[model samples]
Target chain A: MNITSAPPTTDRRIDVALPGAAGQTEAVAWLEGAQAQIAGRAVWSEVRLEIGAGEFTAILGPNGSGKTTLLRVLLGELPLAAGRASVLGRDPGAAKGQIGYLPQRRHFDAGIRIRGVDLVRLGLDGARWGLPIRALGRDRVREAIELVCASEYATRPIGRLSGGEQQRLLIAQALVTDPRVLILDEPLDSLDLPNQTAVSALLARICKQQGVTVLLVAHDVNPLLSYLDRVVYFGAGRAAVGTPREVITAGTLSRLYGVRIEVLTTADGRLFVAGLPEAPAHHSGRHEHDEQ
Target chain B: MSSSALPLAGLSLDPVSDFQQLTAFPFMVNALEAGTAVAIMAGVVGWFMVLRRESFAGHTLSLMAFPGATGALLIGLPAAAGYFVFCGASALVIGLGSSGVRRHRGEESALTGVVQALGLACGFVFLSLYQGVLAGYENLLFGDFLGITRGQVLTLAIVAVLALCGFALVGRPLLFASVDETVARARGVPVRGLALAFLLVLGLAVAATAQITGVLLVFALLVAPAATAQQITCRIGASLVLSVILGVAITWAGLALAYFYSEPVGFYITTVAFTIYVIARVTRAVIDHSTLLRRRPEIAEAHA
Candidate 1:
């Protein structure tokens, strides 16, 4: 401890870094040529990937591509059988609360009858069972509602809400604790265009303003191009990680998916990649807004 | 209706004087007192029942006690104590056996189904064995509430205190866990322990009421008032308080009515509670519809 001198300012501001942020932990993930076991059997081998801090990397691959499995490893929900996976410069298990996880799909306990505000309150501290919840508290609940811009239906029971409304409520719940790293698995499900815009905008704000590190699992990159800092393409039993502009080349796209691929910018200037081995597009130039 | 006015009553089993039945006898007072006390615990536990979506568990618990009660009779032990032991043990077993919420099977529902079957099986077995040896025990099965004594009422008072203390201690975590077990577990709560504690409390309560109303009729005191309160209210604290009031009234009113009739006491208690539940349900629906209608004016003005 240091004894302070007499110099004083009228006001002082202190900055706090977010979780999985710059300088808090070395943002480097190192993996050797190790096999990933699935269902007690080794389906793939010799996988290696490195992810650095402050990187918004979208992991993309074909269906059944193990992208979701890879997210689980990063969240420590699954054990890496042959390879070691590290998160926030430590084992993933050590940082569960520190990391925010949004799964591809989750069923809300329909029996849990509560308003959107109370659901978000569960995120703040009620997620844990032992602690008491004063869901009626004024300011904190208000702040959470405002943070998510979920004030409109804050008092609306979740059972009466639409899919987009529920999605926002889920995101608000995820953000209630202000986690350091936000990892989302296909968060764009059932979202409308406006909601998608609102969510992406909010995520970008969280990343930039709060410095929260984000790892998004998405099939397409159009909605995410502006928000993502990098792309991690996984295929043929390996992963390649770098910037979207660097990773979205025709060669990289074809190599990642193993098919004839085309990357096109829409008339609205949205970056879209069209490639799939099966389920050929009816039109060569079909507008497949992946999440919109 | 005469007290041995007909001489054939001398050959009958344990005939009672007609005058002994008309007044507020000591045993009748004890029955009403014990019934009301146990009903308080029922209200509180039943709040959790509605919250946790385990009203079915309430029915299953009453049934589960049947085997334990009958088995106690076979072994020549106090059926109430046996119920406590069996139901408590069943609670712990259910806890250890159940693999938390996320499961391929609905373990609680499955366990309840099994318990119901076992209860019926044991009831039949005990009935065969007890054809003549357990004439009064049949009355105990549905409860001759007029037969309740001061000792049982005192026991009910003690249990009411313990149940209240348990409620105060775990009230918050209990609601949180009931609301969402998976999320609560992730939040570092001992979710399984909370679940077990709640189940044990539930067992203890059902056992207490079973003394006055029997395992067969405990549901009237255990579930009816609480469930009726649920229909009219959403706030848990208010619902709990209302349920207790409703429970006490049901039993007290049933006791008063039993004073005037020759019916089984459980029958009156259950009928009163069920009637209250139906009335509350209907009234609540009408009130809610009226409130929506009342809100239509504001909605129209806002649109304008």
Candidate 2:
């Protein structure tokens, strides 16, 4: 098993570098020969990638393709079995709270007694022990809420808000930390088309404005295509990375899946892939703007 | 109705003087003091329990009271020591048994049920084997608030302070984890450690409250106030404060009603708590319905 791939070894980095600007274009998250272990067996192995700072990347994979496990590794919650994974140019576990994360949609119980702002405030100092002096943390929390456009429902019960509204609040929670890298797992799942687009655009804006790297895991790539700068598609314990147009092509995805897969493009430039065995099961019945 | 036939029963009907006469007894004063301490501890800890959806664990800890008392009688130790030992031990059993990644509700529930059953069996076994009359069975099961001694009240106060201070130490992180464990874990909150610490605090609360309301009716104090307050408000600080106030009110009023009616204090306490919870739920529903009714007109106008 390869333990650590040589540093300064990446296919994704810009080959040309300015003498004084090395830090600006460095890869925020780098994985080389990474193998993710589940139950002592490698579920995904030999993954190599470099995610640049301020880049918007989408992680696309079928169910059980280790997409979530890969995110967990970057969050430092999971250890790689036989590779090096560096986050923000340091050991991932040592960089706690430096990476803001939005997990999949989680609905609170109906009787949940918390305001939307409180949820975001937890993102700021929720881990701190004792009663939070809201006076000290309120300003930062307010800025986060404003950033996500969630001020209108900031005072409402979190469980009472609509799905789209709740997602915005969750994004605010993720942004409250002013993290260097944002890791989101299916942030747009169960959302309507408009909400999906709006959240994706907001995330892209944050990335551009703050120079923060974003690694988002999603089942489908259609909603995120417009804002995504690159794509990491995982299949059968293998990984591929490139621009969306490059990775989602019939030639690339078909070879990745070891099956015939069709990449369908609509008149409006939206891309969809079909003919994979799991495509039928993966298609959500919700109305989409285009069909594959 | 039979109370009317008693010669002195009619005198108990005056609400003001009846309250005064009840507090006139020294034992009643002690009972009130102990009840107040127990109510405060329960209200604070129970709010977190409900938020974490750990009511089953709370119930299991309360059930330990039965074995604690019976085993104390069997081994010649103080019942208070037995209560703390059994409760603290059971908390570890529940916490350690199910403390893993988030989303293991099935295994956690199974562990709670198993612990509760074994604890109840031990209580029954201790009761059968002890040769002396296990005289406090009624007290153990239903409680005798009026029989509380000064020492018991002091003990209750000390336990209340300890539990509340412990809560003060971990309250924020615990709240964050309870509301959203995934985000809390992602942000480096000690989610698993917080779960274990909360279970221990909940153990202290169950041990304290079981003395006042008994093992069977512990939920009367542990769950009712928090549930009622949550129904009325979604703000954490206000809801927690409201839960504490509601808890104290229910205990005090239950004590008074039990005095006037010559009934079991547990019965009055549970009934009053449930009644208040019902009122809060109904009021919340009515408010929601009215808001919906008011919104329909505006929605229609916008469509027009």
- By DockQ, who's the top model here? 2
Any runs in candidate 2 off by more than 4 Å, and if so which?
A1-25, A257-259, A277-292, B1-19, B100-102, B293-304
Write down the worst ten-residue block by lDDT for model 1 chain A: A9-18
B1-304: candidate 1 lDDT, tens digit per residue:
2122222222223224433452335756677678779878888887787667766767777776777777778778877777888778777666666664745238777876777777779767975775457646656667666556677788789988998888877776676667656556655667778877888888888888787777789888887887787677655556778989988888776665555555666778989999988998799768755655665688656656
Which CAPRI quality tier does the interface of model 1 achieve?
incorrect
lDDT of 1 at B149: 68
lDDT of candidates 1 onward, in order: 0.67, 0.81
Runs off by more than 4 Å, candidate 1: A1-36, A42-59, A82-84, A108-112, A127-138, A191-194, A219-225, A262-265, A269-292, B1-25, B102-108, B260-262, B279-304
Worst 10 residues of 1 chain B by lDDT: B2-11
Q: Which of the numbered candidates is closest to the native, going by highest lDDT?
A: 2
Evaluated at residue B95, the lDDT of candidate 2 is 88
Best by TM-score: 2
Question: Per-residue error at A201 for model 2, in Å?
Answer: 2.2
Q: Write the per-residue lDDT of candidate 2 for residues A132-179, one digit (tens) a residue.
A: 786987899999999888898899888778898999999889888888
What TM-score would you give candidate 1 relative to the actual structure?
0.77
